[model samples]
Target: MKKALAVAVAVALTATACGSEEKDDAPQFAERGTFTYAIPADPGELDPANAVLGATNTVLAFAYDTLVHSDADGKIVSGLAEKWQAQADKVTFTLRKGVTCADKSPVTPQTVADSMNYLSDPKNKATLLGVLIPAGMSATADEAAGTVTLATKDPNPFLLESMTAVYVVCGEGLKDRSVLKTKTSGSGPYPLFESVANDHYVFKAREDYAWGADGAKYEPSMPAVVDLKVVKDESTAANMITTGGLNGAQFTGADRKRVEAVPGIRKGSAPDGIGEFFFHQGEGRAAADPAVRKALVQSLDLNELRTIASGGNGEAATHLTSLAPDPCRGDSVTGNLPQSDPAAAATALDGAGWQAGTDGARAKDGKPLKLRIAYQTSAGPGVQAGMEYVAQKWKALGVETELVGSADAKYSDSLFKNGDWDMAWVPLGLSLPTQLVGYLSGPGPDAQGSNFAHIANTTYDDLAAAAAKQVGAAGCGQWTNAEAALVKNVDVVPVVRPTQLVASKGAMVEVIGGVVRPTSIRMLKN
Candidate 1:
């Protein structure tokens, strides 16, 4: 029952828009105005299951349609699945008929089943499938019945929510995964018309596509073209927004005030569901000690951190999961956080038999307390500032922190996987709760491959499993328990929850919704 309630709340938050009282009055764009958007990074892949990076996820969000989708309010809504049901451990979805893929092939239960099967296949390099689809589960289609049956190993309460991540792809066009590097074929409303690597991408709406809500605020207004430009620099992106070079673009902390101050520049923020510093716990003298980790946690001033990290654009996060404005609803263990007292931090070091050295850095047995902290240069300006802030704070606490910045495209994956640094920064999206599996489970990187922390605990794993099986209120306790255990054990430190900012030209293009989703963007002609 509690599980059911939790699921309901989660669905409600994802499907309904927060603070959306006024009806959207933005005029629809002309049938052929090309809406150019600026994105910081280029998408790594067009394939939904293989693209784990945030930029890639952004592209996939626009290119594909899942069985279920969430609205601005975080409530669950129908996508490809018109209706669904669960009985015991089996869940079935009634596919929406008459939907066609980019190849003009009709969307059927078989297409969904085939796509899911490809994802579930261990041989496939699809990382997201392992987390979204449970092991031993198989998808089967019945054309006559117009339904797809999913058989799970356990009473998977989050099956429908999980299906929201498995995008339906055309079985015919997807002969090789490499083709995703250049082409896309899905049952989404938008079609990839053309793509220029690292520069621009264009999507044209499908006239025959019709699977959105009955009264969706914004549909495909510009049916002819939706263009995306890759602008690496925030200043350039902002300039594009102001000069009418682009209709919309995401902004970071440094550009927040500037963009908000621009006349007729509208802004929107969503709880991005990621706020944590990845502690490289595998090796190194300082990081290898649990007491050192606890002291670092105690020494962090969250309010100050929030100000520096977010440039006053975000609030300090007290828990691992985001707060009420988030799509995924779960209680955070903010109270259980180690006390933010520098004196206590010093005492913790003292208790661990570490004494201050001549240089004001902590040392135990003549070894200095020092560790290398890494941050990806491509994570945008905000993250780079946050890393520097953390370094300064740790230095005050008698810890020597070496800041290492990487410019490599896959720097994060390499850093975490190779245990190359003492700490790193990462972002986790809230679209699916099952994303926690890799961090907690000990199978060494299964599917969805990013268990870089290599963190594992039997008790926490059990709790996570139990939580996964619950849907509503019952699941909350389990989720809370798991979170508490993770935090208490210092599995990951909670940082400031950063809001995703999109800078748009208010005069030329009015943003209809509060938080503009990838699929919900529609330019309004002034």
Candidate 2:
């Protein structure tokens, strides 16, 4: 299936490209060249085990190859494995032959199985764990049979779908894992060439690289050497595209004119991605108060948040899994989640015994109603302004807000380290809400994975578990209801699913699933 898809893409691109035009004027097929793009933030962890940031994904995704690959729409297809069959408590896969790791190591059936087992082991403490693979699942290899069997403890409805996230690295890289932090060592399309710390990372295409998924390749002026430069500022990134010094950038929120102002620059966007707040509802916290959570939800305007967050290019988010190839396939969000009304919010707070003072600050028993809001460190000026706008609106409703930021904060530190924060602007995008099991349940703030909200509701937990038992489209309704359950408890404030917009040189590039995948990009005219 993957090869067929690749063939189709190659055919389409081949048919459209001009063969008669001058070689210099047409797309220059360089034997070896470089492609440069600006990265908004530094990927804190390059290794798959500890990587959590989207910034990291952009880099690591190209540097490593997963066992199973998903399409632009999130449909799972074969990568290193050619085929598979599911059994009662395990799934067996036929490994693809001649696959080689970036280190020039052979990727045998046992090698592939061992890599999966490496991540699955409880002792390894891989952060991805159940989020990427089934909880307590292990893979065993049979070399003679040329197959690997993934055995799970119990039924995993989204197991196959979630396996799409697993990126397999070779045994050599796995032994000395510390070196992987600074370099790339996997069977990925682009291998790591050079690293300039937080400034830039340069990658080179392999001469023997023929394992591209679905006919994906960086041929025809795609540039042999790829330079990923770190440019934190969106406005600055836009200028780089215009000047043609930088090839393109992954930018968010209102920078179309700045980019299109340059000739031959093209822009593409995907409206399916989501970015919303996960309010910390720990005990004694003001957000813990159901009334306070409701008021907080009601006071802030979703539409306004959308406008400011995406510079009017985004729409208000409804469900947790808003992205395509999403496990839960419906707009489960309701209109009653929270409507921004200062009057209503004020009334709700006042009735809950918090009275507005002459200074327009709410206080109860000499305790002022203060809320501290935290935003992502990588957020641009517009997003920061949007957060400030929301803060101002909350302040007008007699609530005082304190804004703070952590430098590329980790998932655990953002929740556990800073226990004082009431509401955080932590936006998590998941292809499956089931990917949130550990986040919503489990032990401590650190143990609960990305459950930054610190919610421990038995009702929501049970509902999610029950929904996880159902498979495929049959489970969509249950999953939708499970999301509704979270909304009902006000565990999270679901906001707009912002459209992820990227601007690039119209030298013929395509943006799939809101990303400029290194392999999928090709050139029309240089």
Candidate 3:
């Protein structure tokens, strides 16, 4: 039974959005069923608007609804919004009628407007704000028109595409942000039915679900329940696949090849996304000097790192926006990264006034040129090897590097607290240049801006602002130029786009853009 409810008051929102992939023609099954998969670790948190990890996105996508989505080819498509139209400074979205939350609460158009407001409020501190919505944007609901209009202070050409990543939450969860930490209140085809701490997670399909991405349609074929488990050991996950105990797993390295050896196993992959080291310049840090930043970047052999990290399955990255669904495509990074030249790097450092000691350590005012570099151990062996390789190469250049913590422990800490590391090889993979705007063009450390690398460039800012005025494909060229400007200046380094190879065991499971769309997975023929 669906409740008939309406918000008498029109919702005025601050502004937030994201992009998504659509699955339209989902397969139907003869009988209700269940599906299970395994993972190496638990995705940290489930909140869509708050969490920063992509792991959270990989799992929660099964239970959330974004306003708009992108097709595999990167074209914008309808999601929760039936359709949208853009004008000079605003984009109007017409919500789908009768969509309901997991708690059976009716998700009115007001719910979406409310969601936008919830994420927009500064006190709420939604991590995705600027990445999805332009700074100083707002939203208004036109009840009579059955639409919610979002307007930015300036223009945002990628507004529609950005919405693909901003999942909508109903009023209940929006009202109390804490509730979302332990529970889910979503409007997608499945709800997070149960989660066994560090062990497994389960979701049951919503029988009356209506708004699924293009690959997922509401019908008889939807899996009755989705079961997910965490199998830490790769061998254990592969064994489960062999026995058909689990339908799929996010495989990597040799495990992917092993899964291919299994007759029934299905392999799926998306561009592994891109990776790069962040040379942080927190107050007085060694890398606080751009010459050190440039010298360090130029010192390492990025080509070799790409080879090790991608396991020879990928090529050097040309764009930071490598997500398959990214609407903009261009080569802004080629020939732009600092070339690996030890002599030139040493010369640059020498010119920067770092006197080389007899021990081969560069020092200024008696402090050796020693710095800590942080990397996440959670990244596969290939990435771990790449980080080590980088450290060794930097050491050989006489720039002392202390390979410190796992980013899992220090990512948030480094960003929010008294930063502990001077250099970090943290690479973020995003589909839109808009997403990169915050990290690439914001104010430096004192303001605590999202520019993790402490980059502040008015030129790039102006270029981005100009790109925002034109919508969609028309503005991609300008956005690329803006990003290229950043790359050219070394404000941010764009690295290689790697492949995310996932090996599946069942023939029934359909994979798109390298992921198993839960709603599209049907039972294998007996």
Best by lDDT: 3
Model 3: per-residue Cα lDDT over 146-256, one tens digit each: 799888887677777777777888856877877888677788777888887678888888888767775347655556888878787878888898888887766556677
- lDDT values for all models: 0.63, 0.66, 0.68
List residue ranges in candidate 3 displaced over 4 A.
1-31, 39-47, 101-106, 133-137, 171-181, 232-235, 282-292, 355-359, 364-367, 507-516
In TM-score terms, which candidate is top? Answer: 1
TM-score of predicted structure 3:
0.84
**Cα displacement (Å) at residue 2, model 3:** 39
**Candidate 2: tens digits of C-alpha lDDT, residues 1-526:** 1111112111111010001111224454444556777776677668777554456766776788766666655666777777877554577788778778887788887777777878878787776665666658888899999898888898777666656566777856767778778877788878888888789988888766666665354454566777888887778888878877787775564575667567766556555356567677776677777888888778877777877876666676777764334656666667547677878988999988889999889998898988888765555555587789888988889888888755443422545555657776655556667666665665544453445567777777777777766665557777777777777767777776665545567344444332346665555446
By descending lDDT, how would the candidates be arranged? 3, 2, 1
Task: Order the candidate numbers by TM-score, best to worst.
Answer: 1, 2, 3
lDDT of 2 at 185: 72
TM-score for every candidate vs. truth? 0.85, 0.84, 0.84
